[model samples]
Target: MTDWQVHALKYADRNSRTRAESFIFDDNHDAPHAMDYFIWVLRRGAEVILVDCGYDSEEATRRGRPILRDPRDALAGIGLKAEDITQLIVTHLHYDHAGGLHLFPNATIHLQEAEMAYATGPCMCHDTLKMPFTADHVCEAVKRVFQGRCVFHDGDAEVSEGVTVHCLGGHSRGLQAVRVRTEAGWLCLASDATHFYENVFENKPFPIVVDLQNMLDGFARLHELASDRSLIIPGHDPLVTTLFPQDGPEFCWRLDRGPSGDFNL
Candidate 1:
């Protein structure tokens, strides 16, 4: 079995977020909470798979979240160009996740079946439900589908030998999580499944949930997927950068090596 090397690359973040927006019905909802945006890279030899594409500059401008570094440049730092990516695992269709679909023209996209339906289906008609998604990004996926570059998974399926995706819909109707075989063991990239360590450890749901129960269940699943909590990577936690061995505070953090030290809630 090939041990996949995984790296979490942070491109942007929002320091103005509040706990109220992160957890539901929490007493400290008014306290400050921050979020770091990232796209994970998985590679071992010639196989290179991208987890999610961070949002583009336009989305950053509209959402009031500025990009600290272009995700493309971040990938460049790791010696990968856009064309070098051949497989893309889209956990969901949220703007921040799928917004950069155009950035990688050569990669075949892997996604959950229900996610496409939820994005293009009746559920997207609701403003609140559609807020996290951008029409352009969804359409980009649609375009890839038309070009025969998209692969849909009904539930749990393996995209490659040591890489698999599991549908853990909570934040979105068809949201999924990625599991990879790394040096430490089976590592779970708990994308929106658990936005932060607190979301799972504290059992608090992120405010933007389609199925609250699914989100909660996914947390338990995350634990089951990884050998230890340190092997599980949250989708947007700033603590990630500090907890792992990385070159800097706002760049790539190696996930396959496990955490450098202990972390508490």
Candidate 2:
């Protein structure tokens, strides 16, 4: 099988009071939680593919989330220059995930066809549905489509030899997860499909969901696609950084290698 090195580059984090019920549907437990924001890089020899373009400082301030560092700068810490990135997978067009697309001047963005429609169509007319997205970010993606830099996928598609994007729209109309063949095994990057390991392992749906049934089904899909439960990486969990081996003092974690710790779940 073709193999690639995967790295999770964390750019910012926030501490907030979250009701457990909000994360796990129908269960109530108010408490504090830490949410981390990250962008992933998959490298196979000379080829590089980025998962998401994290939000900038302005976005952080606008959203009331703290900015640790610019995502482009964070990518640099992992030896990747934003301008050189030619391929990117946008999981969704939410402000936090798609806000920094302009940084990659020469990149072909891969997105789910449903996602583009959801972001630009009538669904966004609802305040609840539109709250998670930034119009400017969605517009940027539209511009990319016009520029011939956007590749829309209807469902599961191979991005390269060992990397595939699975369209599992639950969190958003076109949210997708990346499955990568790595030295450790197939690592499924569950970007927002599950924000934390508990969300999947416990079958708990995150509160902000477009389709509850699909969100529940997505958990099962993630398990089916990953090599094992341990190889599945949740999108915003701080435990990911703790479980995987860090690349150095930097915020990047090496995902191609087996995790440093045993899977707690």
Candidate number with greatest lDDT: 1
Prediction RMSDs, each to the true structure: 1.2, 1.3
Clashing pairs in 1: none
TM-score of each: 0.97, 0.97
User: How many steric overlaps are in each model, in order?
Assistant: 0, 0
Candidate 2 C-alpha lDDT tens digits along 1-265: 5689999999988777575634855445667778899999999888999999999988888988877989889988977899989999999999889999988889899999999999999998899999999988888999999999999999999989999999998999899999999988889999999998988999888889999999999999999989999988999999988899999547989988868977767
Tens-place lDDT per residue, model 1, 1-265, is 7799999999988899899988999998889999999999999898899999988888888877789887789999888899888899999999999989999999899999999999999888899999999999999999999999999999899999999999999999899999999898999999999998989887889999999999999889999988888877899999998898995344888989888876554
Q: Any idea what lDDT model 2 has?
A: 0.90
